[model samples]
Target chain A: MGDVVLASLLLPLAGAVAAAVAPARRTVAVVTAAGQTVLAVVLAVTVLRDGPVATAPGGWEPPLGIALRVDGVAAAVGLLAAVVVTAVLAHACASPASTGPATEPAAGRSAYWPLTLLTLAGLQAVLVAADLFTTYVALELLTLGAVALVALGGRGAYGPALRYLCLAVLGSFAFLVAVALVYARTGTLTLDLAAAALPPGPALTTALGLATVGLLVKSALFPLHAWLPDAHAAAPTAVSPLLSALVVKGSFVVLLRVWTALGGDAALASVLAVLATGAVAWGGVLALRAAALKRVVAYSTVAQVGYLVLLLPLVTPALAGGDGVAVDVARTAWQGVLLVLLAHGLAKAAMFLAAGTLVGVAGSGRVADLGGTAARAPVVVTAYALAGVCLAGLPPSLGFVGKWALLDAALTGGRWWVVAVLLGGGLLTAAATARVLAATLREPGPGDGPPPGTPHGREEAPGATALPTPRAGERWPALALALLAVVTCVGSAWLADLVLVGAPPGVGG
Target chain B: MSTAEVYLVLGGVVTLLGAVRLLTTRDRLAQVIALNVTGTGTVLVLVALAATGGGEPDPVLHALALTGIVITVSVTGLALVLVRRLDREDDGG
Candidate 1:
């Protein structure tokens, strides 16, 4: 189990190296994606059965060397990551649009897979690293890979990519400052030891505040989220899934780590909840108003992030009075948090890929322009609808179960306002998703579909094809993903038990 | 409060100024430079933080600082390339 745990960290790096050296791109892509997915599943099971897995690579102990630990939360996230990555990679490989100019850089045919694998490696490292310094470095690597990926966009990509790079680097510097403060206070970078050494004082509080703010910027929360929509909306079709679903969530994983280590200070969680509420309303409004299909999905990501943030306040409601958190409420809330992370990751990745497919077939990305997708791309439309079910927290979806757990937790604590916030976020998401669904399923006039007679839509790029409907290659991958999403929701009860396997003892047990 | 804190304060001031500049400035070059300045401040703060112990500084801290500098430099290089790309986009189509 420990070896598998270690292998999960090394596998992505190994895959990157393998992809670089291999002559064939398709084989390397499949081998790496499949291998990583298997390893992630093994780790998830290991975390469930064994509680927590810890290993110090090269046998160097503690502050000097690095310790990599996988708790239930990390492993559960790893599982979500594995599923999403493999599915997205499969979609990218199968989808005709993915082979276009934008994804193919000047580097080589093999370059895309390596960069993606390397980014996955960095993200995995960030999740498993037991030291702050290592997490920061890993995060930097993640951003570097992501920046390169984002810049591969068409003509307008450069500006958004540059902005992302600047903000991400600045965010890293803030995180570094916080790490230094922790080190100064504890003389060690190991998270557990440093957390133990944290006292209620100016230095610790300041460090936490700086770190939180920095992560907020990186995670694209609320006012600081200016860079996200343009960058995400403008990226190549295949790349948006990686950007929106995984890369943006990386910082929040670190924030979760920092938040946990800080012992979930109630006052701070309260402030975070306020920001989250605003994000829910703000992101929802923007999504509802956005004209572009991809932009709507991007803005919805911001809104979903708000629900994830709400976990902070929901779990630690008693923190405000210094009475300590109620363990039962905290536990249920923790369950809610884990469920939200899992459901959102899967559903959002599916949404991006489905939206990408819609853009590919429709010849336009505008919400108002997405005419006749149901007839033209039925499989993809179905995928989009299933993903929407998850996003909107509809019944039997993991998303619904997650929110149900959260609302239940809130009700237990009698925090009715939070219950309202969660309900509002769901409604807003449903309304926005309805807009896309309606636009997509709307009847295509004589003007819609690839201009009259072009075969393969060659003459009309991004235009409606006269073939009526795209066949299996593009359609199957999305259907598979959507089916998995529906299956996850239906199986959510058992899955919830699995995720709660090694959560903190007092949380959602 | 202490000699090391003096260094910490100075680094914080530098980082704050640079962060404000990075956020406020629309000029690509200025933002890149601001990022570097803020990065430099973080490095200083890390070094100063190590000094506060009144003993030999941790070697890991030095290595970590070097890593930060390397990453910052690479990012700065990448950002500049992107900015140049944007300019070309303007020049042509």
Candidate 2:
């Protein structure tokens, strides 16, 4: 088990190094992503079968040395990171759109493989990091890698990337202060240990508040989401999926840790619930209004993030009251959030990858220009539509299952506001997605260029340029992921069971 | 007041100033510098707290402070690199 944890971390770091220096960087990256996926599955299975797996690196125990622990949350999210990274890498490996043209510099291309692997390493590290300070470091690695990936979009991306870095670093520093204060009070960096030892007071409350604020910034949850849409939309096509699907989730998981440790303070949870409501409404409206395909997808991310935060308010033990119903609500909320997270990751990756393909082929980012996309790239269009089903929480998809769980819990608990948000947010999501679907299904107008996927067809629409023939390699992965999002509903029962393996006190049945 | 309390107050004031500058400034380089200042302020607070154990400093707090500094420096380096890249884009475009 320890070896699994250690290898998961080191394998990617080592692959990152080799990819940086090796001539066959693509080969190295593909192999590493596949290997990491295997490791994640093994780790998840090991934890599910034998309970939680933890390791103390360098033979040192807690309070002296850091430990890497893989409980149910880590296993579920670790598997997510592996699967999403592999799918995006598969797409990137085949698409020259990720790298520059042959005449241009290869620097971005070379940097792409190594940085992505490093980001994966950071993700793995954060999942297993049992200490707050170590989480800070792992998150720094992830943030820096993600910032660079955004900049790979070239000049347009630089400003957003810089803004992302500045804000993210500020958030990290705030979190560090919280960690420092926690240490000053408790003398231990191990999270569970600190949580057990921490006494309620002004200082502890302040530490918790700081940690929440810091992580919320990183996760781009509403009011603090100023940097996200631009950064995600401006990132390289391949990088955008990874950023939206996985990067934001890392900080979110950390926030989950902090909240679970605090056992969901009612006041904090209520505040978060209000902010989440704002995000869903604001983000959904912006997504609806956004003209560019990628920005629409990006804004949808901001909205989806709100649903993730709804978990906190529902999970608060106060809601459970005395009938043991609150405990069941907390348990249901936890499972619902994780399922929503998994569904969103897979679906969002498919949407972005398909969006990139559409944008690339159309030679424009505008939704109006995608009118003929179905004729030109039917597979990509299908992928995008399938992803939309999950995004809108349509039936027989994992998104529906997750949202149903959330709705059931909210209705049972009589959390009317949460119920309103869930139902209303679903309508908004469906409406937002329908705009793109409507455009794609429209008949090709005069400016819409060619109607068929000719082997060598070029988009002759105004301001458009010739692109490489759309390859099967680029189109299939998006469909595969989108299909996975819909098909995984079959496993919802199993997933609900798996998430309870190391359930927190008062959380699971 | 004790020396530790004095340092803690100073650190708080400095952090507040840096945070204000970080929020108000639009200049890229200034923003980076402001972030560094804020991080230094945090380190200062950590250092002051390291002495709370009487005559001997808490080794763990000191270690955390050091780790904080290392992280701040690297992030600063990365921010500067980004600033320079942006500068090149400005010149070329």
Candidate 3:
């Protein structure tokens, strides 16, 4: 089982190398993606059956060698990421060669595959990393691959990609500085060692602040989120799913782990809670007003992450004298937040992929120009609707399950304000989604002729791009991912069961 | 203060200064330079920490230093590409 865990990390990396060497385009995409999916499944099963597994590289002990540990959370995230990567690869395999002249040589495609693979490996590494220094390294690797993938879209993508690269590097440096401080103060890089060395001292506090700020920037939580809208909106559609779905969550997972390992300081927890509320309100408002389809989804991400931040306060066990109701609320809230993260990954990936198809077919992403598109692209529209259901926390979706849990938690914890904010955020998200649907469903204006057929268009023209409409074949991947997002609601029972098994005693609803 | 402590603070100051410049500067080229300086300062700080023998010079830190160098170069290349593209677009317009 341990070997399987190790192999899961190595398989994508190996496939990436092979993809680079393979001559055929189909071979590169299928081989690497399929291999990763299989590895993801194997690792998920191992984690479910065996529980969290830790392995130290090169026979070194804690605080000296790097350690990888896959707990319930890491396994779930790994499996989810695998499903997303496979779906993306399937889409890439079936879609036509992107319309632009090949800015990258044949070899560059091979290089691209390897970079993505390395990124997946890095994400898995970060999830399982037991030491702060190892986590920092994994984060840097993830950023490098993501930045390259952003730039892979050719000249038009250069500006946004450059900005992403700069901001990401800035975030990485801040994180590294924090890691250095922690090590200097504690004389050990491992989380266990640092926790043993902790008492909320100045150095540790500074380290925590720097690390939190860096991760927030990377996660693109509101205010620090200026780079995300452009990066997600501008990147190639195929690349957008991975960027929005998997990469951002990677940092959040680390933040959660760090918070857990740090033994849950009250002041720090409250600070995170405050920031989360702000993120929910600010991101929701911005998402509601965005005009571009992709930008709307991107802004929604900023809001969605707020729910995860709220989990920090909930994860700490309540004192014995505290209300028993509060304890149950905290556990329920934690589970809700985790489910939200999982469901959001699936739904966001589907939304981005579907939006890409719509953009590909209609040649514009502006809500105003997407008129009559829902009629033309029923399947795509349905996919969007399903994804929106999850995003809005509507019934029979995993998203609803998450929101219910959170609302219950907030109410029990006497945090009525958080509950109110969650409800308001949900309503705002629904309104934003409705705005897009309304524009797409409406009849074309009298002055408006049939929308342009091409995918690429004049800079000034709203919907004049010349790319081909999505055929039946191109729609399956989006549909499949969307279905998974919905089916996640059913799977929640099983996930909840697993989470309960691992959860501390007396910590549940 | 120990040399290690002095260098660590110095590195932090340098990185903080570079970050401020990067954010405030309008010139694309200058922004890239500021970012690079920030990266350099970060690496220096990490090296300083390792030298202090607080932590055992863990391989992860070494790995991070290598990763930082590679990423900095790659970002520099990408930034230059964007600068060139902007120049081209301006000329064409």
Q: What share of the true interface contacts does each candidate keep?
A: 0.87, 0.64, 0.56
What candidate 3 gets wrong by more than 4 Å, as runs, is: A62-64, A97-112, A316-327, A446-453, A457-468, A499-509, B51-71, B74-93
Q: Residue A509 CA error for candidate 1 (Å)?
A: 6.3
| DockQ of candidate 3, scored on C-alphas against the true complex (2 decimals) | 0.50
Chain B TM-score (each prediction, in order): 0.92, 0.93, 0.86
TM-score of each: 0.94, 0.95, 0.90
In model 1 chain A, where is the ten-residue run with the lowest total lDDT?
A451-460
A1-509: candidate 1 lDDT, tens digit per residue? 66787888888888888878787765786677788789888887777776778888889986677888887777877777777778877866765355234333566234667777888888888878878888988899889888877776656778998999989888888888888788878878887678778886887788888898888888988878889999888776667878887887789888877876666666788788888999999999999999988899999999988888887776554333323346667777777867887888888888888887787677666787778887878788888898888888888788888899988988887889889888899999999989899988889777655544443212234554254455566666666766676678776766676667655433533
Can you tell me the CAPRI class of model 3?
A: medium
- Per-chain TM-score (chain B), model 3: 0.86
The CAPRI classification for model 2 reads as medium
Backbone clashes, each candidate:
7, 1, 9
lDDT of 3 by residue, A1-509 (tens): 66766777777777667666766645665676677678767766666676667787677765567777777777788888888888877776666432112444454444555666777877877777877877887887788778777766655666777788788779878888887777766767787678668667687677877888888889887678888888887776777888898999999988776666555567877777788888888888888888888888888888898888888777665522246776787678778888889889999988888887777655667777777677678898888888888988888898988888888888878888788878988898888888888887888665432343424421223553432456665587888888888888987966665444334333542
Ranking by DockQ: 1, 2, 3
Q: Over 4 Å off in model 1, which ranges?
A: A99-105, A108-110, A317-325, A450-468, A505-509
Q: In candidate 2, what are the lDDT values of residues A1-509, reduced to their tens digit?
A: 89899899999999999999999998999899999999999988898899888898898876577788888888888888889888889988888665422322468767889999999999889888988888988999999899988878876788999899989988998888888888888888987778878877788778888999999999999999999999999887789999999999999989888877755567888899999999999999999999999999999999999999998888776333435788778888888888999899999999999988887666567888777677778899899999989988899899999999988889888889988898888888888888998887888677664334431112233543453335788898899999999999998887777777776776763
